[model samples]
Target: MLYRIFTDKEAFEEALYSYQTNLSIILAALLLMPFNYLMEVFKWQLSIKSLTYLPFKQATAGVLSGVSLGFVTPHAVGDYFAKIWSFSHEDRKKALGPILVARMSQMIPTLAFGAVAFIVFIQRKPVFDDYSSDYTSWLIPVAGLIAFLLLSFLFIKYGVKNKKWMYYFDLIRKLQLKSVAQLVALSSVRYFIFSVQFMLLLSIFSFPISFQQQFLGIAFMFLAKSVLPTFNFFNDLGIREFSAVLYFETFDISAAPVILASLLLWLINIALPALIGLFFVPQFKIDPS
Candidate 1:
């Protein structure tokens, strides 16, 4: 995939020169990488504190290990399991709820911003004018949102009440409203940091789009990548590139720089952390006994 993009010697040189000239910008984006994971670590600490006390160092290891494992698993399901194993064997079962809550904290910002971005993308793009005019075109996102909310309400109101699910719900019930709010706030900040990092990378590639357009494009891309299911075999390799290229193409943006930027973002945000997580993988004790 990447070989095809870099095959254009001219485009590759241009990107290389751009990175050289904008070294500060590139560094700034890279710097945010740690802070992004730091936010996640904090969220993990907060989420699991209800069940057990997790020091910052251990939480950091657990979060990165989750990232490492999640990188290869479909929908990052391995993320949940990795974090759950961060606990002692006895607390692992109850750890499920907090892990979920931690994930949901980050998801809220993505969905909220993504929904807004989706609406804006469709509205602003002339290609979507026909779909926008047709009322039915709006049904997909709206229906999805409604169904998500309905299911969430049902789970909190009824699903947790079932005795069979008490093991999972017990830790969730222990979370204070204040703590949940903190998680949301931290997630929002983390989302903003990574989103800005992406925009910074795009700027390095000289995308020529306004801040508004870049933001809308990035948000929509994240939303698409999040909601769409990827095959386990693919491990989410091409999804971001596909989403970014698809959105930016409407702006007459070339696929080369966009793809490069997306790939770099993945390298900084996902691949690097996943590599770092390899060290922590040994720390995860699978057997409580």
Candidate 2:
């Protein structure tokens, strides 16, 4: 028998390798996109609550303007400025509040995923007996914590740092606690769902990795982005690929299929969102003066 002729170890490896070549996982990852899109809507909901009691249409416009700008500018700074400008047209201070909060919602899950992945990376390394002195890998979580604390302090102390409490400060106060908590919670939910996107890519290729491992893999990808903020052009493509390669090496995971999976996820996760922004030609009623 072929099974008897081949050693059991060899037989298992053959089965594993063969199993890794199927497409079921990619289909699963694709299912995550709608969840990601729905997560965006929650941000819209929070933004609406943070604004000047405007109807959903106006707040939606502000959200669209923010996203549209995020698409055009390097690193999505354009979206931040666009939101500020769009909201300022109605209530500059109030509009700025949610725009600020929206960013917090966006990053929480990114950092959370990265933190867990870093832990997994460390654990996964001893299995291979291949070690690198990049202890700086540990810095991602530390820096993220420091940065989050610093920003939170600033938002709490100086978000309305001026005495115009009635106009901006008080309104910002109303949003400060709830918005931050919601964004953080929402971001975590978003990350879990987004991992499904990655799973789909691997499923397409018949890769046999767990969703949790995929999450850690994807987390490391994002962590690498935070580690090197200056290589701004494709928003961490090289960093992401390098990180993926690093993780893949641990499982004796081949480079080609992993790279393929990473690239496909990137296309789905980033490029698609930017493309969606193109359809957001909003009509705002801000004065021409």
Candidate 3:
């Protein structure tokens, strides 16, 4: 009986390996999505151009610095700080002013779309059939997202002028309104492009979900993965995959396809950038200011 049980376990393992291997191959093919990431870089450069007269190369460096730092740092704090650091070499206020406004602008559309999806979740069911489904239920995420937007906006608008939160709030007062508006528009474009990339990734999986369903699901998963607590230094690997599994359940998506889509996205969005940063690391030098 013991030998039979061991044999069964081994067979199960083999089947699992086979499934993962096949899925990985499909995902590998889809990793070409990185080519689309350039849209995000382009949008960021445009945002900077709206604010100040920057050379194309310098504006691009800001984007590169942001993306590289975003991958390495938890909660993207590193990316923001890196931007400030890079820009401070020229002018401290110039760097901090645009970065904060640009960050807020980017979050607006994400929070807005996520709010819609959250409401849909609340109307559906109280307890999620999946483990953490209830916790991830739409109401709280939507509320939190909305609250974050309000507070961030207020902070950027008023708090920046007042020293209530931190001296950093003063920086917001310095931002040019036209520049902020331009950044916000650029951010919206970035968000739309990202949604499009996910739609394409889903198509590669042959998932039957509609474009709205696909984008909404992808948005929720992306927000969850970005905000979720993680123990790893790199991307929140298992947490993100788990979120994908739960989010995809609404569309009757299978674990294999969800996993494939998630993996493909991670490889392109995070892995590829991180890998390139690795090559660029040797070239990274700290200039003594």
Candidate 4:
């Protein structure tokens, strides 16, 4: 599976050779990765503010630590525990709920944009047209997707709960709308930054496709990667690379540049954070309290 997903080493080398030598694009993307983490740290700080007055420095530590631990765990849900490691013994138990609330809030933008990207993919890709010659036939799925996303976002925004639900999620139940909004906003901004970064990398590598084509492909690629669960970090990349090929090939975008861009993204965003996060991980001890 690894070989199949990440094959064509020669081709990737060629793509890297053409693009990586350009120092400017590489430097810009490398620089942007930290801002990406900073936005997330702020989002997390807001999420936990009501529960406890976690300092900005501590929050940054927690978020980066979570990133490192999350990289190894399935779906990175390990972050659920990793972020709370920094809190006081009493607050650690209470912190889980707000952390989950922050996570779900971020998911809203992913679902919304992902649904739109899927719609775009279906509309523009010839494969969809080939799958159904009738123009009206596609509307059924498109409309369904739009409706599903709308309902999903609505649920996220105003989901209901009774005392029973709150009983299990005591800290999470304390969540306020303002914090959720901040998280959603942060997540969206981070999404836009990375998506633009991917586009810039593609241009650097000279992927032969229009801006709209590249946008749609990367948008759907992210959507698919987020929704699909994976067992390990490498598996996460496998899913990303596979989706890139699936989405970009429709636009006649070659696998080489997309793969190289995906690799760069993983390196600067995932690998770097995870390594930086490791230094902070030792700052907290695991105390569930």
Q: lDDT winner among the candidates?
A: 1
Tens digit of per-residue lDDT, candidate 3, span 227-286: 567643566776666666677766666555555556666776777676654443334344
Candidate 1 weakest lDDT stretch, 10 residues: 126-135
TM-score leader: 1
After superposing candidate 4, which stretches have Cα over 4 Å from the reference? Answer: 1-10, 124-168
Regions of model 2 farther than 4 Å from truth: 1-28, 53-68, 84-89, 123-171, 205-210, 282-289
Task: Name the weakest run of 10 consecutive residues (lDDT summed) in model 2.
Answer: 126-135
Question: Which candidate, 2 or 4, would have the higher lDDT against the true structure?
Answer: 4
Q: Give the per-residue lDDT of model 1 (tens digit) for 229-289.
A: 7753335768778888777877777777777778888888988999999899997778744
Better of 1 and 2 by lDDT: 1
TM-score of 3: 0.69
Give a tens-digit lDDT track for model 2, residues 139-251.
66657764885477356545655566446444446666556677667767777676666655655444466666766787787777766665245445666767786886676
Q: Order the candidates by TM-score, highest first — what do you get? A: 1, 4, 2, 3
The lDDT of model 3 is 0.58
Q: What's the distance in Å from true for residue 201, model 1?
A: 0.9
TM-score of each: 0.85, 0.69, 0.69, 0.83
User: Comparing 1 and 3 by TM-score, which wins?
Assistant: 1
Per-residue lDDT of 198 in model 4: 84
